[model samples]
Target chain A: MTTSAIAEALRLHPGPVDLASIETDAAPGFDGKKADGQTALADLGSELSDLQERLWAERTAGSERRVLVVLQGMDTSGKGGVLRHTIGLVDPQGVRITSFKAPTDEERAHDFLWRIEKGLPPAGYIGVFDRSHYEDVLIARVRGFAEPDEIERRYGAINEFEARLVDEGVSIIKCMLHISADEQKARLAERLANPDKHWKYNPCDIDERAFWPAYREAYETALERTSTQIAPWHVVPSDKKWFRNLAVGQLLLDTLRGLDLQWPAADFDVEAETARLIGEAPVQ
Target chain B: MTTSAIAEALRLHPGPVDLASIETDAAPGFDGKKADGQTALADLGSELSDLQERLWAERTAGSERRVLVVLQGMDTSGKGGVLRHTIGLVDPQGVRITSFKAPTDEERAHDFLWRIEKGLPPAGYIGVFDRSHYEDVLIARVRGFAEPDEIERRYGAINEFEARLVDEGVSIIKCMLHISADEQKARLAERLANPDKHWKYNPCDIDERAFWPAYREAYETALERTSTQIAPWHVVPSDKKWFRNLAVGQLLLDTLRGLDLQWPAADFDVEAETARLIGEAPVQ
Candidate 1:
């Protein structure tokens, strides 16, 4: 498609993300691009497929490495797309994806990470948390999931928590899927339109929407304070999903390249122990 | 790096597979051009991480779409890498990874798909089976997961089972991870020599080593009888893990892309139904 046609297609698509910013500018607060409509869906699908195979190898190899991909975004900011694109790439076993909603009664009683930690993948595994412990800092503060002082203290705790994970050999990559106000309303409205999809919508979303500025403040504070050298945050422009997905895909490739893991020394042997790990698990 | 060095590095770093001989080659084939050894640990590790991302995407998206990935392979043929790759790329919530071995008495009872289907991912999820129902046709014909005549019946039943899934909108991708006897022996020996790794060494694996040809025959027969249009079989090159990972990643990407699932479209009056779907489940 021609550039103008692509721009028009993007206009049909909701959200106003400028992806070029992801690749080039990170400073002036991501001047997001418009979606290329037809191209966005077509390309995201292809890239997702290619990435899937690489991730499967890591799962099968059962190497002593772990990858944690955390996505923190505002409502209707393309967290679902980020998830869809992220899974669009890999095999099912080594990659574990979680979308966090309201905490279970049990979850509320325990330390924030208590429920979150159970979901962390083992070595050579990748875990994606749609909304992770950062919720304790963001939603908890905005929705009163925790006390103000508690929310304030969790920032350091969040940093320490992530630092511990990185130190323990888990590669942590955090993404804040950023979208515009108009985009959020459009998405929330879209969810309100379909029947089969009706299952995904919740009225509480409106309540959350009312506190957008509060959430923004909570998010900004959570992000700035918890964002550390160990786990840097990427505020992805979700208005243009194609760009967001491409950006995420690129980031994954870059980080994977940087990790540089290998099959355990050929002579060192991995089969038995790896097999044993599976064997010892209560065989279903 | 020199051509040889590059070749050595490529050997260890898993990438695209040569599809033509994927059915025949066994081993996580190295791409690194190392004259002294196979792919380096660093390259392989990085490759695994990349593979993991791809696989994670597929797991999450495919699962949401209710896709099942079936991986079958001989000893030391690198099924593990497939697992690693597969899991690494999926959302863990939607990705269910299962490895089938000797069935327990309870599993032996009831139809094969009973246990197998239990492992089936919920609608809108991804399921990965390391060894699957085909065992009724494969090993049952060989070591007998069922009666001799039952094995004959199962081959057809297996075809229908997969066919039914496809008919019901389930996407099935079956792969036979092929490895060479030589590579298998080397890996087997490596596991045996390492004290820590000894636990992974299975005496049963050696017992099957003697019947490699028979197992091959069973695989061929099973493939011919059961490889339906809906769930076509891909014999991946086991030796070249890079290629295997690449091939699988591509295949998964292509598979999910083929489904073309749109985010369930927005539902305007979903609050009531959303509550019901979750409410139907018993609280723990």
Candidate 2:
């Protein structure tokens, strides 16, 4: 399949989704050759950087546009790797990475999206939320953090919030890094086995893992209810780490490419400015 | 003098600043050779773009640093041109431009800095404000829009506001686009002479021109009272537009260069991911 078709396949349709129907280990656009896939990923990375530079430039010279990438995944699903390997390929200054931990005291004082509002990438930026407001629906739902009615309200709130950002020149890319429960178990085991990764191991993560079935249900509801046309959710088959990185990277490239970005034309007389600068003293 | 030294010379010292002591027409670094100065300006533009890209990149991989360029000037002192020529060189996605006009009724309802706070640049962005919070003191003071006591409160409020932003990782570059009264009159006349430029001319601008001395006094006070070490004001001579662009461009380059930015090292095993990708099937 073409990479764009593969990217399109990753997005979840706007309705109830049976997570079982999507294969977590599938690498849809690959040719079963790692070297070629790696090479293709690298080429896409360069193209992504070039497009990002123009998008960044377009904010001042052309229409000021912005992008936000929201990644929601179960623990140990390689969210960090996707960020470092895929999104990390671009210039760091152009990307805003917000790994939303538990809400701070100040953040808890306001509406959930108040902090999200603060986190929205300004015009021309590509913002990444390591774990985003979906937590309000996911963990918040699975753990009974908010009432069902309140959780229902959040779906509408999230849809409206995303629509508002889209209205204000932000393009949202939402992805769920889908990995099988068996794969997650093995990954957790590896993290524990490697002494170097002991620091990354959280006891609460294992406890959270116990509720995997419930968490999957929560994700299904959140995805189905909140996937609007403006900001749809893409359920990326992420059991194979490399495929996950390539898919997310391709998704980002395509999103930025879709922006009608142009390097702004000079509004003044460049010839006159050139002549005048050379003729005059460097003014202070 | 070297271009850097000339750029440094434009910065106004924090204290009692007498506007007459500063020459608005002197081109400090130019050698009466438009070609060489233009070449140097072009070089600065490229350097600025490189540094800004790294700075934008650094936000995720490195320190997540950000810069704000605040331009304050008299009518026709070339703030827009500086934004277009000097700042225009960087990728627009990396730059956020906020041109502050007269506050709307809703804006007037809030504390002055409330609006300013809303416009602060996010990490990794180079934000430009054509006319900024300084307007509160400049036009407000000249027009008696605020009581003397309230204006006194604002001086302290602005200093605190700037200090808070610096603390939050934003480096502010404030410039007063300094042009002489005669230059202003000539620019206004030229605006009228060209029918194409008529849309940019406001009758209120001509009326405000009548209070030039009051405006100068107001500026001198604003510069002296609010030029914090964290956000000092640079008074760029604007009689020559080319020099103004070059000076501001050089200043931005120097500022971003000072940021200790580096590309982020990957936190995951690259070799393993590469191996896994090459070996996996193109799972559909």
Candidate 3:
């Protein structure tokens, strides 16, 4: 079967996005850019752009409703590209994106939730958590930030936290940006191979590979435990970066469209301003 | 003399919510509610929700504008809180926030702008740079990320980068979250006093103290050279967390309100759906 067909079947079935299944058999390396490929991407971007505009409006009018997106993935899973593409499509004012870094002394001082809560999005706004509170349960769980009970407590806390936010009108959209192990290794190797990309890697990241199973368990546990009615998980296939971007872009656009945003009635003299600015519709 | 006075001035100045001056001393201690004393945090949260909604609609409408918020300050300054509160007021769908961590091997590989550009918010979105491209110039100038020419080159790149973002409809809002040196000690001491907080303290944080003077010089240079018409720095006095939250909240509210967001015309079926779900509005 073609990669897309295989991807579709996996998505339709209730299973994880298998890291081993991605086929990376293409003959290596680049020219500049493929004309058709670039055009296809451009076309997709334009189509997504139209939807993004509408979504932006819905976000404003549905001001009562907001979207919270949680992106989780192995390193080099196109999180940045997904973020970049998302940015390319929407109005920056309505959007807020966060890439969680190592906890600060201040952040460590408080419970993880304290820092995460501090970043909660207001109504009618879109907030993206590049790595989210899930870290507390995922990394912290394996790293031993707390005991099993504590981890269990946080899993419940996460659900309740998201539920409350949703009930209060926040739409929590969780995405597991999935990429294959080989794919990740390839990406990591690229970073190592290219001096320019070296800054993105950390020796610690390689060290963390030893604990991949532990982290996978942690992620699975958190995902299983926290995936609830308020915020369901979309294990987005990320083997193909372009398709991943398109899928997410479409999802966001669809959600925003569903919001039914509208401008409020003018509190000021709109007729005067329109006439002044556009100078009388030319008697049309 | 008081930070509140600046806040008062920001309020009095014509615009959206008053862009108040926030002295650290005037910031509210953790009272467990809205940092702005007049409004319960719950209320502010609700208000933020409203603002978020409107801003989002405007964003999705193809305005394709972006907002850059820069927060700089002394250690233990209110930068984290500002980040938290700002994100607190918006939806998470269209935003990404990145706090510059110690350069990773991969990151150190590329030019400074490489990682930074990776974090910039997309179109019609808001990206909050906790510590941003400023680091190349700030830390390089202070900690020496590169040689002198590199630092100087970064400044030009910064100006150009920001200009590019602005030219592409990015509206930059920069703030220096100011805190007193004494406050830093008090906070540090507080952390030290608590055993639970011990892990939070990195000896490196104190090590940075040795370079405080150097860091200050770097910051001054950054402010002088990099702060421009497109991205002027707002020096916020964050001695008081509440006042800081209040002032910044006003700043954001004011900025967004000026954007004049409105919902699109409601669709014909919106009422039908509303009635289908909420059983129609009361007679009115």
- Number of the predicted model whose DockQ against the real structure is largest: 1
- Over A76-165, each residue of candidate 3 has an lDDT whose tens digit, in order, gives 877777775554445454466666877999998988788888777666567778888888888888888778888888888888788788
Instruction: Write candidate 3's Cα lDDT for B108-141 as tens digits.
Output: 8888889988888776565678777777777677
CA lDDT of every candidate: 0.61, 0.78, 0.60
TM-score each candidate: 0.55, 0.54, 0.46
Which stretches of candidate 3 lie above 4 Å from their native place?
A: A1-41, A44-62, A268-284, B1-284
Cα lDDT, model 2, residue B118? 89
Candidate 2 lDDT over residue span A217-263, tens digit each: 89889999998888889999999888888889888887877885665
Candidate 1: tens digits of C-alpha lDDT, residues B98-173? 8788788998777887898788866665678888898777777777556778788887788788877887777787
Candidate 3 matches the true fold with a TM-score of 0.46
Each prediction's interface RMSD? Answer: 11.6, 11.9, 28.7
lDDT of 1 at B278: 35
Worst 10 residues of 2 chain A by lDDT: A275-284
lDDT of 3: 0.60
DockQ of each: 0.11, 0.04, 0.02
Prediction-by-prediction clash tally: 114, 24, 75
